[model samples]
Target: MPASTREAVRTAVLADSDTRWKWGALTARRITPESVEPTGFVLRGRATPTARQLTETGVSDTAPREVTGAEFLREVRDAEARGEGYDVVVLALVGGAVRALLQGLADLGLARRPVIVTGYVGVVYEKLTDGLLLRHGADVVLANSRHDAERFRAVYEGVGASAEPVVEAALPFLGGAPHTPEAGRDTLVFAAQPSVPATRAERAYVLRRLVGHARLHPDREVLLKLRSKPGEHTTHLEEFPFQKLVRELDAPANFRLVYGHMGEVLDRTDLLVTVSSTAALEALHRRVPTAVLTDLGVREALGNHHFVGSGLLTSFDLLDRGLVPAPDETWLARQGVAADTPYEAAFDAARERVAALLALPALPPVTPYYTAETAPGYLPGVLARHRLDVTAPEPRESGLRRVVREAARGAYRQGVQRVAPVIRRLGEL
Candidate 1:
């Protein structure tokens, strides 16, 4: 059902709460106006509850009830059976979730539909997910920046994944909602990443560093932005709870842990710091003068190396000195962050490409549905199967036992974090 005219492109958006809230809404608001009725399917991956949480937090202002993978497949089959079809399907999710949906489509023999896979975040270093969309039959793989598009082409092509349709697209989240100036800009906002710190000790060290920064810069307000609280499930696990850590430290008057929308924070922020978070990119795009803390430098898991020379990517030295660093022109240029604007240039370059791809010819039908690779499975089973080669199975455990196991793991992590300081000293010696 490829439409040469823009008005005729009926679309389906498949995404989770955050992706839909952050990205898919951007698509609906920007690409498909009310004139274009686009259906939406929630990517109910490993967690159904989290999706509900996203909605409760207002992830999708106009989102419908999220459906499961089985439900999504059933709808596709039913639609095809009725000889009804959509012009395009939009995918917006991180690694495995995106992989599962694409494979599911291949299984249903519906891979021939024109599809656009958009990026959810602006990643810094290697995420270990390569040639993902191309290999799974996406007609267009969106790249949010020039550097990202360059990397996408290299990685996808290197893997022998067809390089035909990887196109540059403006970051979906970049458009709309212009920033309003806030009061004073002496606020140092630390975007917390519970998953970044490996061990309990590591997590403590990170928090203490923030505390130390607050203590050093008493004149400045230190705000800690947490992605998830104690019971919530975010992108990563909370190995060491920051709330727990805060109680242990004798914090300064101005130092406080906080929770709010990033946009609001950026409006008032003078400086943004993180280990290696996509938030830094957002801050930089907003011209908020950001820093990437490299205290734990070159950690691939946290994707820290990605910030190596990003001028504002700093150590604890500046924090200790009560200093805030501005974005480096060379670094910003190298990262392809625009010189004047707070947004990435590639995002603007991509607008037409996405619209054009939607107008291209429809994909060929998967003549034989359910290949050995695409056989249907539940979300958990599908994810486990797809990760077979790379990820080991997590031993089945639940309830208090699972919590106890995580606690033990956290204790072990604490032991390691304690040793990390010594390890650094010994390495220097």
Candidate 2:
């Protein structure tokens, strides 16, 4: 595709309804053309059919309603057509769904061009899809953390790809805020997505360590905070259903089981525990005592916390003492985490690096089939392999249905081709 044509496809995908629904908050709310400053683009939504627009528009509800597959396809097609005009498309779903959705879109003839796709950690589908999109025609992939960024690179570097660490739209806690530690309570907060790999086994070990420690420090309390429920991404681990581990520990009346925001929970927390999570960085930013007990590779790549004496390779030793040891501030400073600052300078520095990395011409294919000199080299292959057959529309449907159908097929096929390598590698590992 020509550069202009590629730009058009990206514009359509970003404008797709699914992108808006999943990543709407991050993309549309934070990074829209309007937010870029000076070159703000005014968003122009397409006009609805007169008769359809005339139907009674009801008040919005808190609960989200599900869209049927047909409706979903139609919305994507609309977005694909619109993607050509936009620079980015933020996918809000988990990594897995994002991957599948991309394939689905490609199957409908909507190519993953020009637009960038961004998403969060909980959306596993988003993770998978974002990588695929990068490999195909996406200009950039935005990851939530350095850990995630490195992970993305390890998985999809060969695919037309590069990732930047853009902190997701999280609670802004930069300014110094008073957070009273959950004093006298021997609590460890598990704030990451419960479905993360090896979560249960890891949690089990941590819990046993905590239980042993609590018995030693009878005065201290141990609180475990869990998600409301197991999300779709949670595969192997059994969640802390009804705070099961809390009850099973059955140590003392002082022990508490809590749920909700880590920032809020951290207010009363003496210690934070996890295998490898972005939350540990959050905890360290707030000066919360933390311990790293796993060998998750990204943690190794990112390096360990210098604050408190706890190393990335440390055991759950604090739990043995029923105490939360303050981190080694000297070590933390080396990692660029400051005791005086409320926000992490390390993260800020990482963002700068990310900006530089993104500025580099994304690594092109060995054959260089998609550049100015080779614009037409693969155009026929793209069109021939991407053609979609729209099912004949009924009299009740508008003529645009055919366009929507074809777009969906093309987008999905493009997704599969892009993500196949990542999927194969994942299976092998």
What TM-score, over all chains together, does every model reach? 0.75, 0.51
User: What lDDT tens digits, residue by residue, belong to model 2 across residues 307-337?
Assistant: 2254533555644644444566555543334
Candidate number with greatest lDDT: 1
TM-score winner: 1
lDDT of 1 at 314: 70
How big is the positional error of residue 155 in model 2, measured in Å on the Cα after superposition? 6.1
Provide the RMSD of all predictions against the true structure, rounded to 1 decimal.
7.8, 11.9
Scored against the true structure, residue 112 in model 1 reaches a CA lDDT of 43
lDDT of 2 at 19: 19
Evaluate residue 346 in candidate 2 and report its C-alpha lDDT on the 0 to 100 scale.
25
- RMSD in angstroms, candidate 1? 7.8
